[model samples]
Target: MASANATQSVYLDYAATTPTDPRVVEAMLPYFTEIYGNAHSGHRPGRRAEQAVEDARETVARILNCKPSEIVFTSGGTESVNLAIRGVTLSEKGDSAKHIVSSAIEHSAVLKTLEQMASTNGIEYTLLPVSQEAVVDPETLIPALQPNTALVSVMAANNEVGTIQPISALAAQAKARGVLMHTDAVQAAGQLPLDVQALGVDMLSLSAHKFYGPKGVGALYVRDGIRLTPSQTGGSHEEGQRAGTVNTPGVVGLAKALQLAYDEFDERTAHYRSLRDQLIDEVLRLVPNARLTGHSEQRLPGHASFLLDGLDGNTLIMHLDMKGLAASSASACKTGNPEPSSVLLAMGVPYETAFGSLRLTIGKDTTETDIEYSVSVLAQIVEKLYRLRQNYR
Candidate 1:
């Protein structure tokens, strides 16, 4: 049963970011006040801080099934992706032409970094088309690889549409050709099993804030024996891969948050799937022309997205906001842009219809009552918008 005062707006934008878990906060408090020494310093307090950082690294490495030395801490997912792609380019040591292969629906962080590298460093890239459900076929990737290809970069899942990619198969293809692979696992980290050996990727990226940790901190997993040139240079830090004074509190929070998430993965994912299914079913049933986006099953358990005829998602989101319900029309990163979602466009949705994209994601604190309230509010908004359109016509 919902509380009598449960009229607060529902937060359905977990894909964008999540509130920090209290346990993670508790773990991070000591680092902020008492043990606030630089990890690079050699004093007693510094050694203690360094120990905390190393322990946190071990925790993250254990979760990702990689060596602690392979885990490189960065600002967040964007920097992690940038470091992986840029660092790989710098390490290739090739006089030959360098090329990269990636899917069309990648986040702006990946796409924009590729664009910048192409213009500045003379690195070439190919954006492969995906299926209508936004899945990249590994068969298509083989033909795109070249002898000079430095890396094959793809996301583990679609941030907007919630479509899961066949990462292991894609990684296998890359490895057979002697090409390195990297995946932005920011969206998939807490919700999916991310065993690095099983995934068979050379590198992967994750952001702490996406999985209920503090912002401004993330980790990149580089497989043992994989060499990446340092992206940030100054002092020797993060094994000389990233150079800076480390955020002891943020890293501690990241490790604690990931530990909690890993422990409750089964229960949390099951709950999300159930609520997600109900949210999808109820909205589709109660509203006309409500088309569910992404794969029906092979998607993140907590994610649901849709398109509606004769309705723009931005306008619908505004209406829902007025009704005490929060949601997104596309990637939160691209919010307020009147343009249609590139993810929907890549999925073969018509340009006009793509403007109607809506993404709703469940989180750890989301409940059945919240789902019920969200669906009811969404149905009402859609119906009213349609009626208004009919009258105007």
Candidate 2:
């Protein structure tokens, strides 16, 4: 049950960003105060900071089933994706091949970088479309792969629709063709089990904050023996692949968060899954035109995206806000834009339906009562918005 003293309001935007866990905050406090020092400095303080960074790297590696040296810390998901794409593209092999394959529904971090490269003639890119179920067909990707295809990038899960991709299958295909495979696993990390080796991805990106850690820190996993050029040039940090001072405090918080999430994965998954199912059931029961988006069964544990006909998603968001329920129309990164969701568009949803989409993601902190209240509020807002649209028509 939500306490009457709960601060702010009900937060349903975990897909956008989650509050830093109290445990993570506690873990980070020492670094900010007593252990304040640059990881690059040459002193006891620096050594302590450097050790903390290494510890965090090991924790991240353990979670992903990769070597500690394979994890390159970056600013966040965006930087990780940029580094993975650009580094590979600038590599000797990538420069010669010049062709890349990805999904149309990838986060803008991937799409935008690929677009910029495409414009420069540095790479020829292909974006495979998704079906109405938000699943990309592996067969379609096979046809798009050229002999010179240097890399294939797909997301482990779609951030907007929560559609889990068949990454292992896709990676296997890329492997057979001798092309490297990368996956943006930012949204899939805590909600799903991630084993880079099992997934057969040559590279994977993850954000700490997405799983209850501090912001401004993330990691990229590079499979052993994969050669790539450094995207950022500076100090010999991150095995000389990435430069600049390590974010020691953020890394510590991330490692702690990752460890906690892994420890509680099964319990948290079950909890969020139950709440998610309940929310879906209530919305379908109460709302006449509510349609669930994404893979109905293969979706992320906590993601619940729906389209309410005749209701503007922005309007519904505002209404839900007024009722103290937080949600979004698409990925938080793409929110506040009037454009229809690229993910939805690629999934064959009409523009009108795309504009009517709402994404509500539950988290570890989300309670059963909270889901009940949010569902009740959403049903009411959708009905009200539909009637308003009808009247205007």
Candidate 3:
């Protein structure tokens, strides 16, 4: 295959996950060999581990502008999302509260948890609709809010289309109504500027792997004074919220990666935007019937999703891969799921168009040459697919 041609390989799937920065790995090296210790233990090694965990917490807090005591370590984004939504709704006082208001475009973590809550706990929920651009207006939540509403869970940015949500407006409305607000910021963690206080959200989720840190480690920020029932009951780790052995290196890596991200924010954002805009413009010009998804300007710096009317997204992905360009049809979470992306459907895209959704997210390492090659190959693939379909017809 041409993909094996070495020089042609281009990776454009940063939205799914990122390559862990070597600097983060260097920071974490000692934890596994020299500094290995259970964070919960009281001895010297344990105390050392505990100090690392606390330092990581402070680093994360510095970026989010939250208190260190408010951060809860977890496995990853899914676990953090579940803990934030379920932990609150299932709390002693929260059990009586019944409704949740969120957008149809939320990550499946938020949507599925709400679904389970509605089914098992008899809690009521409403999914606000999105525009054709796959964005939810903040005002949509005003009418959905009810006296029984307990929490409002939305994403700071979408996993599929990379649409930025009006978190401040949504959180402000929820706060005025005395309802709690939570956001799945896994996709937005390092790509966009995130300050929980500025966003007016009581809770937020961040994953290390989403921002050039290791996988299997993430954190949830719950505003100080907010109470949540423990998801896993046992040890008093994570302020008695989650129970498990702390991943010492993972914690250190998360902080180190986030610190690097904060330091390189402006430079990275500009680079990503340049590649993203170049790709979008070239694809629209080169491929027939191509339509861009999500808000044109409000989208993430590295995101450029699309719907090509006459081609199948999966087929296009395979063709791109054979040419040594890596991309995805949608969220990585939906891998092996045959159905079209629910995110595109929620945006009112036609069934056929949803099947053709293509997501190509750039990263800090992406280059001008990679963008040019991807566009050249993509145009050829789309043309070839159309010809094959016509021959079949």
Best by lDDT: 1
Best-to-worst order by TM-score is: 1, 3, 2
Please estimate how well model 1 matches the true structure, expressed as its whole-model Cα lDDT.
0.91
Kindly list the per-residue Cα lDDT of model 3 for residues 1-393, writing each as its tens digit.
122334488999999999999999999999999999898899999999999999999999999998999899898899899999888888735445888888898888888889998899888899999888877788889999988888899899898999998899999999999999999999998888889899999999999999999999999999988888877888877878998888999999999999999899999999999999999998899878888999999899999999888577888898888988899886877765678889999998877668888899999999988888888888778888989999999
Q: How many clashes (backbone N, Cα, C below 3 Å) per candidate?
A: 0, 0, 0
Per-residue lDDT, model 3, residue 201, is: 95
What is the lDDT for 352 in model 3?
A: 69
Candidate 2 accuracy as lDDT: 0.87
lDDT of 2 at 116: 94
Check candidate 3 and list the clashing pairs. Answer: none
Which wins on lDDT, candidate 1 or candidate 3?
Answer: 1
Clashes of 3: 0
Residues 1-393 of candidate 2: C-alpha lDDT, one tens digit per residue: 233233236788998888899999999999998888898889999888888888898998998998998999999999999988888887746356898999999999999999998887568899998899889888888899988888899999988889999999999999988889999999998999899999999999999999999999998999988766777788888878898888888999889999999999999999999999998898888766999999999899999998876567887888888888889997787667888888888888888778888899999888878877777777666777778778988
Question: What lDDT does candidate 1 reach at residue 158?
Answer: 91
- Tens-digit per-residue lDDT, 1-393, candidate 1: 233234557999999999999999999999999999898999999999999999999999999988899999889999999999999987888745389999999999999999999999989999989999989999999999988998999999999999999999999999999999999999998999989899999999999999999999999999888777878888888888898999999999999999999999999999889999989998888767899999988999999999996698989999888877889998998888989999999999999889898899999889888888888788777888999989999
